[model samples]
Target: MYIILFNLLSWVTFFVFLFVLYLLILWMWGNMTAKVPFVGVPSKVLHEIEKALDINDDSVVYDLGCGDGKVLFYLYKKNPKATYIGIENSSFPTILAKTRNWWHKKFNTSKIEIIKKDFFEVDLSNATHIFTYLYPSLMDDLLPKLDKELKSGTKLVSASFHFTTKKEIKEIDLKRGRYQLTNKIYVYEF
Candidate 1:
């Protein structure tokens, strides 16, 4: 009986080790390789976000996570006078955002900036429109900051995850994931 118990404990420990490795892999990939936990904002959602917020050519838009800075880049393509800011915590994403911003500022007709830092550390009060693709867990840390930092009538957009407190201005299904409806954008006003 003791031997059997030992074997069971060993197996449990081994599985826990594997699970931890998996989580580490996810974090590293999200921060470096971006294999998972990093997905671009879908075009459908971007369209709706811009439309819902009534984004103008001169709007100051801030994209949290800003993976590859596609959302901000595309928005700049549409409106050249708009100021785009990207907050990316991961090295790979931040580097990519920097490269993109450099090229666009080099030749393109607009100015875009990328900052390497966690979204929670940045100030969003002056942001006319804010975009994020982060999960609900991040929301737990961000809601209070949002409540305190953002001004009245500022637009907040999230892809796939929902915050518990804010009133969602719109919800639409343009894509479906394996276990959930994906193309969902939640817009909030503060």
Candidate 2:
């Protein structure tokens, strides 16, 4: 009798947890679609960007909607002098970035900062390059902001979706059919 009750309780808890996770996903999507929806950059894509963009020590890259901060981590490893900043609104990912950066700092490594705030509010005049994988709607909203804030030569690298309803010629299409990578990243220079 006791075993039966415990099993039922466990099943109930599991279902409840699933429902909670589902609700959280929707809530997060509503708040920060592609912008901060916890997407770490794909390894192949990251390498491709490094080669194409010629990521140097002087590049100041900001990954908008930087989830668990994998892109920033990759950038830090690639170029030590490159200042990497990630603007993430979610609490969990912000904490993750903070902890990871703290550990790296303790070991005397690259300077990676994760700001737990909305990217739309931050000043982007100093950003040499901006990396993002946000959804189309969010990107659309950010388009005007970028146009106003970012300088003429600033680079914008977008993953998965485009902001405006326009075709990009300088896009990198990788692993289209059988390969795992589904999103085609577009790079634009302003």
Candidate 3:
């Protein structure tokens, strides 16, 4: 009986490690293909973003290149009446976000829609609020597209990057301890 129990424990540990390794590989590959690494915004920063946006009950929020649906789900939890849409190109993050949504539905009735497609391909005309954590180059490419597509009075909240065309309505400073972070939260209006 002792030997059998030990064997079972060993097998369980082995499988757990294997699963972790598989997930790591999947994440790396997805990032490589998407050209942007999956960097989840800190919970503190997310809260600041929520506060800065002042999301309302009727706001339609879209998170372009939303890795793991963190922002969308966070906002949804705060305001369930609002619509939150997440667009993710990478497969691993999309699958992870979808699974999280499925599990989240058990207690919360708010539904967060996750789209597995390139951010460029998704439509932004109907978005009342948009959020992103993209690089400078991507932001440059996206500026004209968003200006052309988004309706007037749309709010854009970007983390770690700024848009070239639109002037920032508000900029929030995110600092921790002695180090003042450079990834300031920028809010823009269209």
Candidate 4:
């Protein structure tokens, strides 16, 4: 019994070590390639995001750099009829998002897609709403792509960072809450 218990404990430790190593590598890769670390939108911010977006049955929402699909999943619950797409470049977060999406599909009839590709590479022509929680510089870099692809009157909601070139139609500041790590959410119309 003691021998079996020791073997189980050793296996657990080895798996734990592998998980940590995987995360470490992913972190480094994200920083080097995307120039942004993987950070999930806080629960408080999700509320603000939902309020910022005007999703409908015909709406096609895209969450750029969607880490673990948390934002898309939350929005999916709110607007089940709307089509949701998550674009994640990092492998670990893509895997996590896909796993969560698989589980979510089992219980609901929502349309959620997790694509493991750079957001820049994907065409944004069909998106009715776009959500991003990326760095300021990256947000600036994304403006040209957004301008080129998104059709007229498309809504772009950005958390924490705003595009310098585009003027935001609405901006919400959430400083009162305890979970308010990123205080501002900007909304723009293309």
lDDT at 110, model 1? 61
lDDT of 1 by residue, 95-162 (tens): 66797788777787667889988787888888888887887878757889988988887888787788
Worst 10-residue stretch by lDDT in candidate 4? 173-182
Model 4 RMSD vs true structure: 2.4
lDDT of every predicted structure (CA atoms): 0.77, 0.78, 0.86, 0.90
- Model 3, residue pairs in steric clash: none
Evaluated against the true structure, the overall lDDT of model 2 is: 0.78
Per-residue accuracy of model 2 over 54-74 as CA lDDT, tens digit each: 567788889888877888888
User: In angstroms, how far off is 74's CA in candidate 4?
Assistant: 0.5
Q: Using lDDT as the measure, name the better of candidate 2 and candidate 4.
A: 4
Error (Å) of candidate 1 at residue 85 is 0.4
- Pick the lDDT winner: 4
Steric overlap count per candidate: 0, 3, 0, 0
**Clashing residue pairs, backbone N/CA/C < 3 A, model 4:** none
Residues forming the 10-long window of minimal summed lDDT in candidate 3: 174-183
Of the candidates numbered 1 and 2, which has the greater lDDT value? 2
Q: C-alpha displacement of 53 in model 4, angstroms? A: 0.6
lDDT of 4 by residue, 1-190 (tens): 9999999999999999999999879877876776788889888678889989979989999999998999999998888999999999998788889989998889988699999999999999999999999999999999999999999999999998998777899988877565556788999999
Distance from true location, Cα of 85 in model 4, Å: 0.3
